[model samples]
Target: MSFREMTITLDDVLAFLHLPMGGRFYTPGYATRAEAAQTCALLLGGSASDYALKFDHVKTIGLRFGFLQELYTKALRDRRYGPATQMWLVHVVGSMLFACKSGGWYTTVHWISIVEHLDQVLEYAWGAIALPTLYDALGHASQRKTKQMCYYTSLLLAWVFEHFPPTIIQRMEVPDYTEDQPRACRRRESRTGHPELMERQVIFDEMTAEDVIWTPYEEHRDRSSAAVSVDGAYADYEPYLIPEGVPATIEGEVVGNYLDWYTTVSHSVYHPG
Candidate 1:
Protein backbone atom coordinates (compact mmCIF):
# COMPACT_ATOMS: atom_id res chain seq x y z
CA MET A 1 0.00 0.00 0.00
CA SER A 2 2.78 2.39 0.82
CA PHE A 3 6.21 2.81 -0.76
CA ARG A 4 8.07 2.35 2.50
CA GLU A 5 5.95 -0.66 3.32
CA MET A 6 6.93 -2.53 0.14
CA THR A 7 10.50 -3.63 -0.04
CA ILE A 8 11.17 -5.06 -3.48
CA THR A 9 14.17 -6.84 -4.93
CA LEU A 10 15.54 -8.43 -8.19
CA ASP A 11 13.60 -11.68 -8.28
CA ASP A 12 10.66 -9.37 -8.79
CA VAL A 13 11.44 -8.15 -12.33
CA LEU A 14 12.97 -11.33 -13.75
CA ALA A 15 9.81 -13.22 -12.95
CA PHE A 16 7.92 -11.57 -15.80
CA LEU A 17 7.73 -13.73 -18.94
CA HIS A 18 4.53 -13.45 -20.99
CA LEU A 19 3.45 -11.08 -23.75
CA PRO A 20 1.15 -10.99 -26.74
CA MET A 21 2.89 -13.49 -29.01
CA GLY A 22 4.36 -11.74 -32.05
CA GLY A 23 4.15 -14.97 -34.04
CA ARG A 24 7.91 -15.00 -33.98
CA PHE A 25 8.65 -17.00 -30.89
CA TYR A 26 11.62 -18.54 -32.60
CA THR A 27 13.40 -15.27 -33.05
CA PRO A 28 16.58 -15.35 -31.07
CA GLY A 29 17.41 -12.61 -28.65
CA TYR A 30 20.20 -11.09 -30.78
CA ALA A 31 18.88 -11.98 -34.20
CA THR A 32 17.93 -9.29 -36.67
CA ARG A 33 14.36 -9.08 -37.87
CA ALA A 34 15.22 -10.81 -41.15
CA GLU A 35 17.12 -13.54 -39.40
CA ALA A 36 14.50 -13.92 -36.72
CA ALA A 37 11.73 -14.04 -39.29
CA GLN A 38 13.47 -16.79 -41.13
CA THR A 39 13.84 -18.84 -37.97
CA CYS A 40 10.34 -18.00 -36.86
CA ALA A 41 8.94 -19.05 -40.20
CA LEU A 42 10.58 -22.41 -39.94
CA LEU A 43 9.33 -22.84 -36.41
CA LEU A 44 5.85 -21.56 -37.28
CA GLY A 45 5.12 -24.61 -39.44
CA GLY A 46 2.74 -25.88 -36.77
CA SER A 47 -0.42 -24.12 -37.93
CA ALA A 48 -3.02 -25.28 -40.41
CA SER A 49 -4.12 -21.90 -41.72
CA ASP A 50 -2.85 -19.32 -44.12
CA TYR A 51 -3.63 -16.09 -42.30
CA ALA A 52 -1.31 -14.15 -44.63
CA LEU A 53 -0.37 -12.22 -41.57
CA LYS A 54 2.41 -9.73 -42.32
CA PHE A 55 3.28 -7.26 -39.60
CA ASP A 56 4.38 -8.49 -36.24
CA HIS A 57 1.36 -8.64 -33.96
CA VAL A 58 3.55 -7.67 -31.08
CA LYS A 59 5.94 -5.17 -32.69
CA THR A 60 5.17 -2.14 -30.59
CA ILE A 61 4.97 -4.10 -27.40
CA GLY A 62 7.95 -6.18 -28.42
CA LEU A 63 9.97 -3.08 -29.03
CA ARG A 64 8.93 -1.69 -25.71
CA PHE A 65 10.10 -4.88 -24.04
CA GLY A 66 13.28 -4.83 -26.02
CA PHE A 67 14.05 -1.22 -25.19
CA LEU A 68 13.42 -1.74 -21.52
CA GLN A 69 15.52 -4.90 -21.45
CA GLU A 70 18.34 -3.16 -23.21
CA LEU A 71 18.28 -0.57 -20.47
CA TYR A 72 18.28 -3.33 -17.92
CA THR A 73 21.32 -4.88 -19.51
CA LYS A 74 23.00 -1.54 -19.78
CA ALA A 75 22.57 -0.88 -16.11
CA LEU A 76 24.25 -4.19 -15.39
CA ARG A 77 26.98 -3.69 -17.96
CA ASP A 78 27.68 -0.22 -16.62
CA ARG A 79 28.05 -1.51 -13.10
CA ARG A 80 25.71 1.28 -12.09
CA TYR A 81 24.62 -0.61 -9.01
CA GLY A 82 26.22 -3.01 -6.60
CA PRO A 83 25.95 -6.75 -7.34
CA ALA A 84 22.73 -7.16 -5.38
CA THR A 85 21.24 -3.92 -6.66
CA GLN A 86 22.14 -4.79 -10.21
CA MET A 87 20.54 -8.19 -9.92
CA TRP A 88 17.16 -6.92 -8.81
CA LEU A 89 17.08 -3.89 -11.08
CA VAL A 90 17.84 -6.07 -14.07
CA HIS A 91 15.14 -8.51 -13.01
CA VAL A 92 12.68 -5.66 -12.54
CA VAL A 93 13.25 -4.58 -16.11
CA GLY A 94 13.36 -8.12 -17.41
CA SER A 95 10.04 -8.84 -15.79
CA MET A 96 8.46 -6.10 -17.89
CA LEU A 97 8.44 -8.41 -20.89
CA PHE A 98 5.20 -9.88 -19.56
CA ALA A 99 3.32 -6.62 -19.89
CA CYS A 100 2.82 -6.73 -23.67
CA LYS A 101 -0.37 -8.08 -25.23
CA SER A 102 -0.61 -10.16 -28.36
CA GLY A 103 -2.61 -12.84 -30.38
CA GLY A 104 -4.71 -9.82 -31.29
CA TRP A 105 -2.84 -7.05 -33.00
CA TYR A 106 -2.97 -3.72 -31.23
CA THR A 107 -5.68 -3.33 -28.66
CA THR A 108 -6.52 -0.72 -26.07
CA VAL A 109 -6.62 -3.53 -23.59
CA HIS A 110 -3.09 -4.44 -24.53
CA TRP A 111 -1.81 -0.92 -24.13
CA ILE A 112 -3.74 -0.32 -20.97
CA SER A 113 -2.66 -3.67 -19.57
CA ILE A 114 0.99 -2.92 -20.16
CA VAL A 115 0.67 0.49 -18.59
CA GLU A 116 -1.05 -0.88 -15.53
CA HIS A 117 1.59 -3.57 -14.96
CA LEU A 118 4.37 -1.06 -15.44
CA ASP A 119 2.93 0.78 -12.46
CA GLN A 120 2.29 -2.21 -10.20
CA VAL A 121 5.81 -1.96 -8.86
CA LEU A 122 5.84 1.81 -8.79
CA GLU A 123 4.27 2.02 -5.37
CA TYR A 124 7.06 -0.14 -4.04
CA ALA A 125 9.88 1.55 -5.90
CA TRP A 126 8.67 5.04 -5.26
CA GLY A 127 7.49 5.06 -8.86
CA ALA A 128 10.90 4.47 -10.38
CA ILE A 129 9.49 1.59 -12.36
CA ALA A 130 7.12 4.06 -13.98
CA LEU A 131 7.90 3.97 -17.70
CA PRO A 132 8.49 7.69 -18.11
CA THR A 133 10.91 7.58 -15.26
CA LEU A 134 12.75 4.64 -16.83
CA TYR A 135 13.05 6.57 -20.09
CA ASP A 136 14.47 9.47 -18.17
CA ALA A 137 16.92 7.13 -16.46
CA LEU A 138 17.91 5.83 -19.88
CA GLY A 139 18.83 9.37 -20.91
CA HIS A 140 16.45 9.51 -23.83
CA ALA A 141 16.40 13.23 -24.32
CA SER A 142 13.84 15.38 -26.12
CA GLN A 143 14.34 16.36 -29.71
CA ARG A 144 12.74 18.78 -32.16
CA LYS A 145 9.54 17.37 -33.66
CA THR A 146 10.33 16.36 -37.16
CA LYS A 147 8.05 14.55 -39.57
CA GLN A 148 9.87 11.40 -38.44
CA MET A 149 10.59 11.72 -34.71
CA CYS A 150 9.20 13.55 -31.73
CA TYR A 151 11.57 16.12 -30.30
CA TYR A 152 9.87 17.39 -27.20
CA THR A 153 6.64 15.45 -26.95
CA SER A 154 6.07 12.14 -25.19
CA LEU A 155 6.72 9.98 -28.25
CA LEU A 156 10.44 9.65 -27.62
CA LEU A 157 10.45 6.10 -26.21
CA ALA A 158 7.92 5.04 -28.80
CA TRP A 159 10.12 6.32 -31.58
CA VAL A 160 12.98 4.37 -30.13
CA PHE A 161 10.97 1.18 -29.71
CA GLU A 162 9.38 1.36 -33.17
CA HIS A 163 12.46 2.35 -35.09
CA PHE A 164 15.55 1.38 -33.08
CA PRO A 165 16.19 -1.94 -34.75
CA PRO A 166 17.13 -1.02 -38.29
CA THR A 167 16.45 -4.63 -39.14
CA ILE A 168 12.72 -3.88 -39.11
CA ILE A 169 13.06 -1.84 -42.29
CA GLN A 170 14.33 -4.79 -44.29
CA ARG A 171 11.23 -6.71 -43.30
CA MET A 172 8.79 -4.07 -44.60
CA GLU A 173 7.37 -4.02 -48.11
CA VAL A 174 7.42 -0.32 -48.84
CA PRO A 175 6.03 2.94 -47.57
CA ASP A 176 2.41 3.59 -48.50
CA TYR A 177 1.19 7.07 -47.73
CA THR A 178 -2.48 6.46 -48.36
CA GLU A 179 -3.47 10.09 -48.08
CA ASP A 180 -7.19 9.70 -48.69
CA GLN A 181 -7.73 7.64 -45.52
CA PRO A 182 -6.82 8.01 -41.88
CA ARG A 183 -3.87 6.03 -40.52
CA ALA A 184 -6.13 3.58 -38.69
CA CYS A 185 -7.95 2.65 -41.87
CA ARG A 186 -4.64 2.20 -43.64
CA ARG A 187 -3.48 -0.11 -40.87
CA ARG A 188 -6.64 -2.16 -41.32
CA GLU A 189 -6.04 -2.19 -45.05
CA SER A 190 -2.38 -3.02 -44.61
CA ARG A 191 -3.40 -6.40 -43.16
CA THR A 192 -4.21 -7.12 -46.81
CA GLY A 193 -4.27 -4.21 -49.24
CA HIS A 194 -0.74 -2.85 -48.95
CA PRO A 195 0.73 -4.71 -46.03
CA GLU A 196 3.52 -2.17 -45.96
CA LEU A 197 1.30 0.30 -44.14
CA MET A 198 0.77 -2.04 -41.24
CA GLU A 199 4.39 -3.07 -41.21
CA ARG A 200 5.51 0.46 -40.52
CA GLN A 201 2.52 1.61 -38.54
CA VAL A 202 4.46 2.02 -35.34
CA ILE A 203 7.25 4.17 -36.78
CA PHE A 204 5.17 6.76 -38.59
CA ASP A 205 2.16 6.53 -36.32
CA GLU A 206 -0.27 9.27 -37.23
CA MET A 207 -0.63 11.62 -34.33
CA THR A 208 -2.63 14.79 -33.93
CA ALA A 209 -2.35 17.35 -31.19
CA GLU A 210 -5.32 15.70 -29.53
CA ASP A 211 -3.56 12.40 -29.15
CA VAL A 212 -1.41 13.77 -26.36
CA ILE A 213 -4.06 12.92 -23.81
CA TRP A 214 -3.62 9.20 -24.49
CA THR A 215 -0.34 9.13 -22.64
CA PRO A 216 -0.07 7.34 -19.27
CA TYR A 217 -3.15 5.27 -20.14
CA GLU A 218 -5.58 4.74 -22.97
CA GLU A 219 -9.35 4.72 -22.55
CA HIS A 220 -11.15 1.41 -22.90
CA ARG A 221 -13.96 1.96 -25.39
CA ASP A 222 -14.52 -1.44 -26.98
CA ARG A 223 -16.21 -3.47 -24.31
CA SER A 224 -18.62 -4.88 -26.87
CA SER A 225 -15.78 -6.30 -28.94
CA ALA A 226 -14.60 -8.41 -26.04
CA ALA A 227 -17.11 -11.16 -26.79
CA VAL A 228 -15.23 -12.10 -29.94
CA SER A 229 -11.63 -13.08 -30.41
CA VAL A 230 -9.41 -11.66 -33.15
CA ASP A 231 -10.49 -14.43 -35.53
CA GLY A 232 -14.17 -14.02 -34.78
CA ALA A 233 -14.07 -17.22 -32.74
CA TYR A 234 -15.33 -17.64 -29.20
CA ALA A 235 -12.57 -17.94 -26.63
CA ASP A 236 -11.96 -17.94 -22.93
CA TYR A 237 -10.59 -14.61 -21.84
CA GLU A 238 -7.61 -14.55 -19.53
CA PRO A 239 -7.16 -12.06 -16.77
CA TYR A 240 -4.44 -9.45 -16.85
CA LEU A 241 -1.04 -10.52 -15.61
CA ILE A 242 -0.29 -9.85 -11.99
CA PRO A 243 2.30 -7.28 -10.97
CA GLU A 244 5.26 -7.91 -8.68
CA GLY A 245 7.54 -5.93 -6.44
CA VAL A 246 10.29 -3.71 -7.95
CA PRO A 247 13.15 -1.97 -6.22
CA ALA A 248 15.12 1.16 -7.09
CA THR A 249 18.87 1.45 -6.56
CA ILE A 250 21.21 4.35 -7.27
CA GLU A 251 24.87 3.54 -6.63
CA GLY A 252 24.07 2.80 -3.00
CA GLU A 253 23.19 6.43 -2.25
CA VAL A 254 20.10 7.83 -0.58
CA VAL A 255 17.21 5.75 -1.99
CA GLY A 256 14.59 8.14 -0.68
CA ASN A 257 16.48 11.04 -2.18
CA TYR A 258 16.13 9.61 -5.66
CA LEU A 259 12.46 8.99 -5.01
CA ASP A 260 12.05 12.64 -4.12
CA TRP A 261 13.85 13.66 -7.27
CA TYR A 262 11.74 11.38 -9.49
CA THR A 263 8.49 12.55 -7.92
CA THR A 264 9.22 16.19 -8.69
CA VAL A 265 10.24 15.75 -12.32
CA SER A 266 7.37 15.32 -14.76
CA HIS A 267 7.41 12.94 -17.71
CA SER A 268 4.86 11.21 -19.91
CA VAL A 269 4.50 7.50 -19.13
CA TYR A 270 3.23 6.49 -22.53
CA HIS A 271 3.70 7.79 -26.02
CA PRO A 272 1.15 10.12 -27.58
CA GLY A 273 -1.36 8.44 -29.81
Candidate 2:
Protein backbone atom coordinates (compact mmCIF):
# COMPACT_ATOMS: atom_id res chain seq x y z
CA MET A 1 0.00 0.00 0.00
CA SER A 2 3.03 2.33 0.51
CA PHE A 3 3.98 2.28 -3.21
CA ARG A 4 1.52 4.73 -4.78
CA GLU A 5 1.50 7.35 -7.54
CA MET A 6 2.75 10.77 -6.32
CA THR A 7 0.21 12.59 -8.49
CA ILE A 8 -3.39 11.57 -9.10
CA THR A 9 -3.31 8.67 -11.56
CA LEU A 10 -6.79 9.61 -12.76
CA ASP A 11 -6.59 7.43 -15.88
CA ASP A 12 -5.14 4.47 -13.95
CA VAL A 13 -8.00 4.53 -11.44
CA LEU A 14 -10.60 5.11 -14.16
CA ALA A 15 -9.25 2.30 -16.37
CA PHE A 16 -9.08 -0.04 -13.38
CA LEU A 17 -12.75 0.65 -12.64
CA HIS A 18 -13.53 0.01 -16.37
CA LEU A 19 -14.90 3.52 -16.37
CA PRO A 20 -14.59 6.16 -19.10
CA MET A 21 -14.15 9.74 -17.94
CA GLY A 22 -17.39 11.00 -19.48
CA GLY A 23 -16.39 14.67 -20.00
CA ARG A 24 -15.11 15.17 -16.40
CA PHE A 25 -12.75 13.07 -14.28
CA TYR A 26 -15.89 11.86 -12.54
CA THR A 27 -19.62 12.32 -12.71
CA PRO A 28 -20.90 15.77 -11.65
CA GLY A 29 -22.63 14.28 -8.60
CA TYR A 30 -19.35 13.49 -6.81
CA ALA A 31 -18.03 16.15 -4.34
CA THR A 32 -14.36 16.45 -5.43
CA ARG A 33 -11.75 14.91 -7.78
CA ALA A 34 -9.67 13.48 -4.92
CA GLU A 35 -12.78 11.99 -3.36
CA ALA A 36 -13.78 10.42 -6.69
CA ALA A 37 -10.28 9.04 -7.40
CA GLN A 38 -9.84 7.64 -3.91
CA THR A 39 -13.30 6.14 -4.08
CA CYS A 40 -12.52 4.48 -7.41
CA ALA A 41 -9.24 3.07 -6.07
CA LEU A 42 -11.02 1.72 -3.01
CA LEU A 43 -13.65 0.08 -5.20
CA LEU A 44 -11.04 -1.39 -7.54
CA GLY A 45 -9.11 -2.87 -4.60
CA GLY A 46 -11.91 -3.79 -2.15
CA SER A 47 -12.94 -7.43 -1.90
CA ALA A 48 -16.51 -8.38 -2.85
CA SER A 49 -16.93 -10.42 0.35
CA ASP A 50 -15.72 -7.52 2.42
CA TYR A 51 -17.87 -5.13 0.43
CA ALA A 52 -21.00 -7.24 1.05
CA LEU A 53 -20.18 -7.71 4.73
CA LYS A 54 -19.58 -3.98 5.24
CA PHE A 55 -22.77 -2.93 3.44
CA ASP A 56 -24.54 -2.66 6.75
CA HIS A 57 -22.01 0.03 7.72
CA VAL A 58 -23.40 2.59 5.22
CA LYS A 59 -26.16 3.89 7.47
CA THR A 60 -26.53 7.32 5.87
CA ILE A 61 -29.08 6.29 3.18
CA GLY A 62 -31.20 3.27 2.22
CA LEU A 63 -30.53 1.02 -0.84
CA ARG A 64 -32.97 0.10 -3.68
CA PHE A 65 -31.44 -3.14 -5.14
CA GLY A 66 -33.41 -6.37 -4.94
CA PHE A 67 -32.41 -9.23 -2.60
CA LEU A 68 -31.77 -12.74 -3.86
CA GLN A 69 -31.41 -15.49 -1.25
CA GLU A 70 -29.06 -17.75 -3.21
CA LEU A 71 -26.81 -14.88 -4.32
CA TYR A 72 -26.44 -13.65 -0.75
CA THR A 73 -25.67 -17.11 0.62
CA LYS A 74 -22.98 -17.66 -2.01
CA ALA A 75 -21.38 -14.21 -1.66
CA LEU A 76 -21.38 -14.35 2.13
CA ARG A 77 -19.34 -17.57 2.05
CA ASP A 78 -17.27 -16.67 -1.04
CA ARG A 79 -13.59 -16.68 0.08
CA ARG A 80 -12.31 -17.62 -3.40
CA TYR A 81 -12.08 -14.23 -5.13
CA GLY A 82 -11.31 -14.45 -8.90
CA PRO A 83 -8.88 -11.56 -9.51
CA ALA A 84 -5.61 -11.77 -7.58
CA THR A 85 -3.98 -8.36 -8.29
CA GLN A 86 -4.19 -4.65 -7.45
CA MET A 87 -7.54 -4.43 -9.24
CA TRP A 88 -9.42 -7.26 -7.52
CA LEU A 89 -13.01 -8.22 -6.74
CA VAL A 90 -14.03 -4.58 -6.59
CA HIS A 91 -13.26 -4.15 -10.32
CA VAL A 92 -15.31 -7.22 -11.21
CA VAL A 93 -18.33 -5.94 -9.28
CA GLY A 94 -17.83 -2.29 -10.18
CA SER A 95 -17.52 -3.10 -13.88
CA MET A 96 -20.75 -5.13 -13.85
CA LEU A 97 -22.65 -2.32 -12.05
CA PHE A 98 -21.21 0.39 -14.30
CA ALA A 99 -22.07 -1.60 -17.45
CA CYS A 100 -25.64 -2.15 -16.30
CA LYS A 101 -26.14 1.57 -15.63
CA SER A 102 -24.39 2.61 -18.88
CA GLY A 103 -26.54 0.21 -20.90
CA GLY A 104 -29.69 1.97 -19.62
CA TRP A 105 -30.27 -0.76 -17.04
CA TYR A 106 -30.65 1.49 -13.97
CA THR A 107 -30.46 5.11 -12.79
CA THR A 108 -27.09 6.95 -12.89
CA VAL A 109 -27.44 8.76 -9.55
CA HIS A 110 -27.26 5.43 -7.73
CA TRP A 111 -23.85 4.49 -9.27
CA ILE A 112 -22.48 7.93 -8.30
CA SER A 113 -23.60 7.32 -4.74
CA ILE A 114 -22.17 3.80 -4.83
CA VAL A 115 -18.82 5.15 -6.05
CA GLU A 116 -18.83 7.57 -3.10
CA HIS A 117 -19.44 4.74 -0.65
CA LEU A 118 -17.15 2.00 -2.06
CA ASP A 119 -15.91 0.88 1.36
CA GLN A 120 -19.49 -0.01 2.32
CA VAL A 121 -21.13 -0.06 -1.12
CA LEU A 122 -22.64 -3.53 -0.75
CA GLU A 123 -25.49 -2.40 1.46
CA TYR A 124 -26.61 -0.10 -1.32
CA ALA A 125 -26.23 -3.06 -3.72
CA TRP A 126 -29.74 -4.19 -2.85
CA GLY A 127 -31.07 -0.92 -4.22
CA ALA A 128 -28.30 -0.16 -6.70
CA ILE A 129 -27.17 -3.54 -8.05
CA ALA A 130 -29.42 -6.48 -7.14
CA LEU A 131 -32.65 -4.73 -8.05
CA PRO A 132 -31.20 -3.23 -11.21
CA THR A 133 -29.83 -6.60 -12.31
CA LEU A 134 -33.23 -8.17 -11.86
CA TYR A 135 -34.79 -5.22 -13.70
CA ASP A 136 -32.35 -5.55 -16.62
CA ALA A 137 -32.86 -9.31 -16.72
CA LEU A 138 -36.57 -8.67 -16.96
CA GLY A 139 -36.05 -5.93 -19.57
CA HIS A 140 -36.15 -2.16 -18.91
CA ALA A 141 -39.90 -2.08 -19.34
CA SER A 142 -41.75 1.17 -18.60
CA GLN A 143 -44.59 1.18 -16.09
CA ARG A 144 -47.25 1.82 -18.75
CA LYS A 145 -45.87 -0.91 -21.00
CA THR A 146 -47.35 -4.37 -21.01
CA LYS A 147 -47.85 -6.06 -17.65
CA GLN A 148 -44.10 -6.77 -17.22
CA MET A 149 -42.85 -3.15 -17.16
CA CYS A 150 -45.91 -2.12 -15.16
CA TYR A 151 -45.11 -4.82 -12.65
CA TYR A 152 -41.46 -3.76 -12.47
CA THR A 153 -42.49 -0.11 -11.97
CA SER A 154 -44.87 -0.99 -9.16
CA LEU A 155 -42.31 -3.17 -7.38
CA LEU A 156 -39.54 -0.60 -7.85
CA LEU A 157 -41.79 2.26 -6.73
CA ALA A 158 -43.33 0.35 -3.85
CA TRP A 159 -39.92 -0.80 -2.62
CA VAL A 160 -38.46 2.70 -2.84
CA PHE A 161 -41.58 4.21 -1.30
CA GLU A 162 -41.74 1.77 1.59
CA HIS A 163 -38.24 0.32 2.20
CA PHE A 164 -36.22 3.45 1.40
CA PRO A 165 -34.85 5.39 4.36
CA PRO A 166 -37.50 7.73 5.78
CA THR A 167 -35.10 10.62 5.17
CA ILE A 168 -34.43 9.53 1.58
CA ILE A 169 -38.16 9.25 0.84
CA GLN A 170 -38.60 12.76 2.26
CA ARG A 171 -36.14 14.10 -0.33
CA MET A 172 -38.32 13.13 -3.33
CA GLU A 173 -41.68 14.83 -4.06
CA VAL A 174 -43.65 11.58 -4.17
CA PRO A 175 -47.40 12.21 -4.14
CA ASP A 176 -48.05 9.81 -1.26
CA TYR A 177 -44.79 10.17 0.68
CA THR A 178 -42.81 13.43 0.88
CA GLU A 179 -41.43 15.80 3.53
CA ASP A 180 -41.70 18.92 1.38
CA GLN A 181 -45.47 18.88 1.28
CA PRO A 182 -46.26 22.47 2.40
CA ARG A 183 -47.06 22.78 6.10
CA ALA A 184 -50.00 25.12 5.43
CA CYS A 185 -52.68 22.52 6.09
CA ARG A 186 -51.76 20.82 2.78
CA ARG A 187 -49.25 18.14 3.66
CA ARG A 188 -49.82 14.97 1.65
CA GLU A 189 -50.01 11.50 3.25
CA SER A 190 -46.93 9.35 2.70
CA ARG A 191 -46.61 5.68 3.66
CA THR A 192 -43.67 6.44 5.94
CA GLY A 193 -45.16 9.64 7.44
CA HIS A 194 -48.50 7.91 7.85
CA PRO A 195 -47.94 4.34 9.02
CA GLU A 196 -51.39 3.27 7.95
CA LEU A 197 -50.60 4.10 4.29
CA MET A 198 -49.57 0.66 3.11
CA GLU A 199 -48.86 -0.06 -0.54
CA ARG A 200 -51.31 -2.77 -1.54
CA GLN A 201 -49.34 -4.58 -4.21
CA VAL A 202 -51.23 -6.81 -6.63
CA ILE A 203 -49.08 -9.64 -7.88
CA PHE A 204 -49.97 -11.32 -11.17
CA ASP A 205 -49.61 -15.02 -11.91
CA GLU A 206 -47.04 -16.37 -14.35
CA MET A 207 -48.02 -16.99 -17.96
CA THR A 208 -46.52 -18.59 -21.07
CA ALA A 209 -44.25 -16.57 -23.37
CA GLU A 210 -46.87 -16.48 -26.13
CA ASP A 211 -49.48 -15.12 -23.73
CA VAL A 212 -47.12 -12.52 -22.30
CA ILE A 213 -46.55 -9.31 -24.27
CA TRP A 214 -43.93 -6.93 -22.86
CA THR A 215 -44.85 -3.30 -23.49
CA PRO A 216 -43.50 -0.55 -21.21
CA TYR A 217 -45.00 2.82 -21.96
CA GLU A 218 -43.21 6.12 -21.40
CA GLU A 219 -45.20 9.12 -20.19
CA HIS A 220 -44.48 11.11 -23.36
CA ARG A 221 -45.09 8.20 -25.75
CA ASP A 222 -46.05 9.02 -29.32
CA ARG A 223 -49.72 7.97 -29.26
CA SER A 224 -50.56 9.16 -32.72
CA SER A 225 -53.11 6.77 -34.25
CA ALA A 226 -52.13 8.02 -37.72
CA ALA A 227 -50.85 4.91 -39.52
CA VAL A 228 -50.18 3.78 -43.09
CA SER A 229 -50.57 0.29 -44.53
CA VAL A 230 -47.79 -1.90 -45.98
CA ASP A 231 -49.03 -1.66 -49.56
CA GLY A 232 -48.91 2.12 -49.54
CA ALA A 233 -52.61 2.21 -48.65
CA TYR A 234 -54.02 4.22 -45.72
CA ALA A 235 -55.55 2.03 -43.08
CA ASP A 236 -58.94 3.42 -41.92
CA TYR A 237 -57.49 6.96 -41.94
CA GLU A 238 -58.79 9.56 -44.44
CA PRO A 239 -56.82 12.82 -43.94
CA TYR A 240 -58.19 14.62 -46.98
CA LEU A 241 -61.75 15.16 -45.74
CA ILE A 242 -62.97 18.77 -45.44
CA PRO A 243 -65.06 19.51 -42.36
CA GLU A 244 -68.43 21.31 -42.50
CA GLY A 245 -69.60 20.72 -38.88
CA VAL A 246 -71.98 18.09 -40.29
CA PRO A 247 -71.85 15.23 -42.77
CA ALA A 248 -68.97 15.96 -45.18
CA THR A 249 -70.97 15.70 -48.42
CA ILE A 250 -68.12 16.71 -50.70
CA GLU A 251 -69.56 15.18 -53.87
CA GLY A 252 -67.02 13.69 -56.31
CA GLU A 253 -64.19 13.90 -53.76
CA VAL A 254 -60.86 13.36 -55.59
CA VAL A 255 -59.56 10.59 -53.30
CA GLY A 256 -59.42 6.81 -53.17
CA ASN A 257 -62.51 4.83 -54.21
CA TYR A 258 -64.85 7.86 -53.96
CA LEU A 259 -66.66 7.39 -57.31
CA ASP A 260 -70.27 7.49 -56.01
CA TRP A 261 -72.02 10.49 -54.35
CA TYR A 262 -72.66 8.66 -51.01
CA THR A 263 -69.07 7.32 -50.90
CA THR A 264 -67.70 10.88 -50.83
CA VAL A 265 -69.94 11.93 -47.92
CA SER A 266 -68.39 10.44 -44.76
CA HIS A 267 -69.79 11.47 -41.37
CA SER A 268 -67.70 11.82 -38.21
CA VAL A 269 -69.28 9.37 -35.82
CA TYR A 270 -66.78 10.27 -33.08
CA HIS A 271 -65.73 13.91 -32.68
CA PRO A 272 -66.73 17.31 -31.17
CA GLY A 273 -70.40 17.20 -32.16
Per residue, candidate 2 scores C-alpha lDDT tens digits across 1-273 of: 011101212222221222222222222253343443344334333444443333333321111122222233344456423212213333334334433322123222224434344454343313223333435534554334534331123333333333233333332343562222211111223555432212211011112233322221111123312211112322334566454455444433344345443333532122221
lDDT score for candidate 2 against the true structure = 0.30
Error of 1 at 74 (Å): 40
Worst 10 residues of 1 by lDDT: 12-21
Model 2 misplacement above 4 A: 1-34, 41-86, 100-122, 125-210, 213-273
Candidate 2 has what TM-score?
Answer: 0.19
Residue pairs clashing, model 2? 55-123, 64-127, 65-126, 65-127, 66-131, 145-215, 145-216, 145-217, 146-215, 176-190
Top-lDDT structure, candidate number = 2
